[model samples]
Structure formats: C-alpha cells, structure tokens
Target: MSVKRLDWPDWLLSTLWLVVIAFIWWMAVRLLHIPEYILPSPEQIVERVSSSPTYFGAATAATLRVIAVGFMAGVAIAIPAGFAFARIQLLEKSLYPFVVFLQTMPLIAVTPVLIIWFGYGLVPTAILVGFSVLFPVLVNTVAAVKNISPRLYFVTSSMGANALQTFRYVDWPMALPYFLSSFRISLALATTTAVVGEFIAANAGLGYLALRGVRNKDPVQVISVVLIAALIGVLLNAASVLVETKVLRKYRD
Candidate 1:
C-alpha cells in the first residue's frame, strides 16, 4: 500500500518551522533561566515591539526608504553598464578593473568618503546600499549577455537586423531571466546594507535602534529589530519571485 502524502502549502510548512523554533527558544530561556540582558525570550521581544509599534514602524519605513533608493539606483546603473561591457571590449577592459577594485574596498572605508562627499542623511547610506546591490546584478547581467549563443546574433544579423533590432529581439529576452534571478539576491543585500549604513551614521532606522539597544544592554530591543529586518528580507524576496514568475510567463507566451 502507498502512503498518503501531506502536500501542504509552502507557507504552511514555513509557518510550522517558525512555530517550532519559537517554542524551542521559549523552552531554552525558561529551562536555562537565562537573564534577559544576555538573551531576551521571544515573548519579551514581541512585547517590546508591541509596546512601541509606532517607533518600530517609523524605523522600518526609514530603512525601507534607503533600501528602495539604493537598490533601484544600483540596478538602474548596473544593467546599462553590463550591456556596455558586453558590447564594448575597450570600455570593459579599461573600466572592469576599477569596478572590481571598488568592490574590494570595504564599505566601511568607502562610506566615510561618501559621507564627506554627499553628507549624512539618506545620500551616503543609500550609496552604501547601492554598492551592496550593484556588483551581483552587474556580474549576472554581463554573464547573461555574454552567454547568449553567437548563432543567435548571427541569425539576427543575417536577417538584416540593425543594432537596435538585434538588441530588442535577442539580447534583452535572453538576459532578462538572469537579471530577474539577480534581483532576489540584490533585494536581500539591500536590506543588510541599509541597516549597516544606519549603524555607521544615522539617527533613525532599525540599525540605529539596534545599536542603541546594544549600548543600553537591551536584548529585547535588538532582537526585535533583527526579527523585523528578517521579515523585510523575506517579503522582498517573495515579491521578486512573484514578479519574476509573471514576467517570464508573459515573455514566454
């Protein structure tokens, strides 16, 4: 006889896992009698967040604003740069080393320069976020363009296609999937970098809140910020996947 399968929804499985983890955390805190300063219980974190929902909500919005500006700016620059790299050998050879060098430079170091140039507030932080979002998307975009079969280009050329037509019909469609796949990675980076920027120099955002919690020795506040950041990453990733699926389906059809 065959065993029956559960075939549960993906969200249900994820929820169950989250519940299990929370239960384990609760048990550990209770059994070990851990001090809240050292490690706040999950319940305590929830209580902290609930106590000042507006404060946390404003922090979330600020972080998201940075992430949005940075992520968009990064992708907007990276795609065209990738295309140019693929199309122009001289340009790529001349600039690719600099791009790689810039990537190697620690954001912590570069951020001060950005701060000096752009001043504080959103600009420097967003640029840091953009840096985090930039490299992966750029590399993927280049790979996507380069990986296209030479025969495909030949076919377009043989059909008397102009540069614009060739790109419209061949380059873009082939590269789109790679670009979308990179988007998921970039979104996650965007969140982390935004928080890091806040950590370095900002009065607001979850990173600032977390830093304050650290100085104040408030484990609950720090953990609450962490949970919120994780939630944002998950939601952004899910949204990217949904959009990718629909866009690919439409393109394929």
Candidate 2:
C-alpha cells in the first residue's frame, strides 16, 4: 500500500489563516486601547500566564488528569455499550430513551447533587466529566455501527466469517472514523466538564483559579483563565483531529 503524503499547501494555508487572526487580535488590542481591567491584550494575558507558571502548571495538571481519566472511562463504557445497543434491538429499545434523557440533563443541576453524594474531590469531577461526554460518543458509535454497509456484512457472512471475524475485518474499520469523530466532540465536552466540576468545588485547577479571579474582581485574570481553558480545549481538539487523520487515512479517498 502506498503511503499518502501530507498536503503542504493545506498546512501553509492554515498557517496563513492563524497569522491573520493573530494580526487582527493585535490590531484590536492596539486600536481599541482597551483597559487591562476590562480586556487585557493577548500579550498581557500571555505574560500573566508565563509569570504565574507555578500556579497555572498545578492547575493545568489537575484539570488534565481529571479530563484524561474521565474521558477514558467514558469512552471505555460507551464503546461496548454502544455496540450492544446497535446489535440488539431490545437493548436499543430499552436504553436509547434513557441515553437521550441523560444527554439532556443539565450538568450544573447534577453537579451539586454529585458533590453532596461523592464529596468534593477528583472522583466527583471525573464522574461529572464522564457523564457529560458519554452520550455523544455512545450515540455516535451506535449509529456508526448500525449504519455499516449490508453488502459488507453479506460478503463476510458468505465467507463463513464468525461474528468476531466480521467485526474485526469489516465493522471496526468502517466505524473507526465515526468513532474518532465522536471522540473529537467528547474531548472538548470532557474539558468543559472538568472546568465545571472544578467550579462546583475545588481548591485547585484552572477552573478554581477562574472562580478566584471572579471573587477578587480581577477581570484580567478571569479572562486569562478562560483563554487558557479555551486554548487547552482547542489543542485537545486539534490533537484528536491529528489522530483521526492518521487512523482514517485509508478511508480518505
């Protein structure tokens, strides 16, 4: 099999786009002369983030740990359960509505109850992130599996392929792209969930820092934390996209 090469032109275009955005942001900061209290320039925000490495590092680490653990757990549970739902009509009929309901439930409302039950710590935070991100992955995976080509199934079965064989050779490969797409969405949700979880209760994390900023009426710090969190989310999403590209390269054509 021939390996596909990266499109340098695409990379160049993306870089140009980023440069344009940065230029616009710089222009806005310079032209508007926004007060540091109201809207710190990106340069000031970066300086703050750089100067407070000790605090920001600890907070980032704590938040990332929660996000990683919760995201993994969510994916672990969602994938197999999704497959079961897709494969079994009765399971689908029984569980689909509940999944939908869970998806619709507000995390803000649930967070307090979770803290009450689980106490304030990493456990509750992990659970919150997991719960927040689980539905999209579960539903998307199920849909991906269910939508597998009937012809592929027939061809596999005609060759006397066992269920496992069919799944390994056909179903998995077909669903991988969709699964990755779901995960891309889940990663961002997981990060947001982690932040929310910390907001509910925590002495550490970017979220906690954000809350502290708010309490202290430090808008610059507040905006800084938010920008950092947003950056992390964007980075995580970009990482997912990279992984998805690598995994789904064969299907790109």
Candidate 3:
C-alpha cells in the first residue's frame, strides 16, 4: 500500500503538545516568580524524580499492584454481573437500582466507612479501586450485549446454537468494542481511585509519598509523585487504546 505523508502522526502531535505545555509552564513559573515550594519548576520536579528513582519506583510499583488487582477483580465480577443483568430481566429490575446507586455514591464520603469496615490497608484500597471501576464495566457490557440486533439472536437460534455458542459467535464479537471502551475508562478510574485509596490509608504508594511530601514540606516530592501518577495514567490509557485498535480493526469497516 502507498501512503500519503502527513504533517505529523498522532504520537508526534501528542509529544509536541506536551512540549508546548511544558514551555508554557516554565514561562509561567519564571514570569510569575512562583516559589519552588508552592509550584516547583518542571526542572525541579525532574531533578527530584531523578535523584530518588528507587523511592519513586517502589512507590509506583506498590500503587501499580493495587491497580492491577482491582482492575482484574472489577472485570471478573462486573462482566458476569452484566451478563446476568442482560439475561435475566427480573434480576436486572431487582438489582440494578442499587448498582446505579453505588456508581453515584461519592467516594470521598464513602472512604472513611470503607476504612472502618475493611480497615486501613491494601485490601480496602483494592476494594475501592474495584468498586470504582465496576459500574462502568457492568453498565457497558450489559448495554452492549442487550443492544445487539434481534435478527442476530434469531439467526443463531435458527441455526440451533446453544447459549454458549450464541454468546461466542454473536454476542462476543458485537460487544467487544463497547466493552473495551468501557474497560479503558474503568482502568483510568481505577488508577485514580487507587491513589485516593492510598491517600486515605497506606504506608506506601504515590499517594502516600505525596502525603509524606506534604507533611515534610517537600513540594518536589509531591510534584514528583503527581508526575509519576500522571505518567502511569497516560501509559495505561495508551495501552488500552492500542489494544482496542488492534482488536477492533476488523470491525471498523
């Protein structure tokens, strides 16, 4: 295939945007004469990250673990629950309201209750992350599955396909794109909730590091931790997008 050249690829444009933003940030700090402790220069944040790579890396790893577990747990439970909601009208009618309520509940207010119930630790944090991501996945999956054309189901039934076969051959492929989209959103939410979880209670992770930085009057550390969190969110979102593109490429046409 022959391709026409473009001004820039998306990745290049993204990088350029970051650079432009950084330049503006640097200019703001310099022009405004903002103190380092209040708003550390980009250079200072980088210096802080570089100076203590081991520390930040450890913290990031800890938080990453929480995110991973929570993501998996959320998907594991939500997908099945979604299927149930779609397959059983009574179940959906009976249970969906509470599920929606859970989704709408404010996490900040719920955090202390979770702490009291689950206690201060990784488990509560993981649960928080899982809870935070669950509703999106559930809602998306049910909607996707339920939104399929009735003709597809009739065709599968005419072919004498069993429930499992129908799901594999009809529902799975049709629903995957929506599922992946929701999955990406859930993952981003999971990362943020994981940080919030750590902030509420935890010995390690970026949130804890940020808290420590605050207590110790270390803006560089706080900003460095924020930088790491932002990087993780970006990378995760990118990975999700790549996976969706690869998996959904055939569906595009």
The lDDT leader among the candidates is 1
| Candidate rank order under lDDT | 1, 3, 2
Model 3 agreement with the true structure over 117-236: per-residue lDDT tens digits:
878778888888999989999999899989999999999999999999998989899989878999889988999999978988677899999999999999988888888898899899
Model 3 scores what on Cα lDDT?
Answer: 0.90
lDDT of 1 at 208: 90
Off by over 4 Å in 1: none
Per-residue accuracy of model 2 over 1-253 as CA lDDT, tens digit each: 9999866775578668877977787788799886777777777777888999988889999999999999999999999999999999999999889988988988788888878888887888899888877898898889999899899999999999999999899989888888999998999999988997898856688889899988998877888888778878988988999999987886655
TM values, all candidates: 0.96, 0.88, 0.93
The local distance difference test score of each candidate is: 0.92, 0.86, 0.90
Best prediction by TM-score: 1
For all candidates, what are the clash counts? 0, 0, 0
How well does model 2 score by local distance difference test? 0.86
By summed lDDT, the worst window of 10 consecutive residues in model 1 runs over 112-121
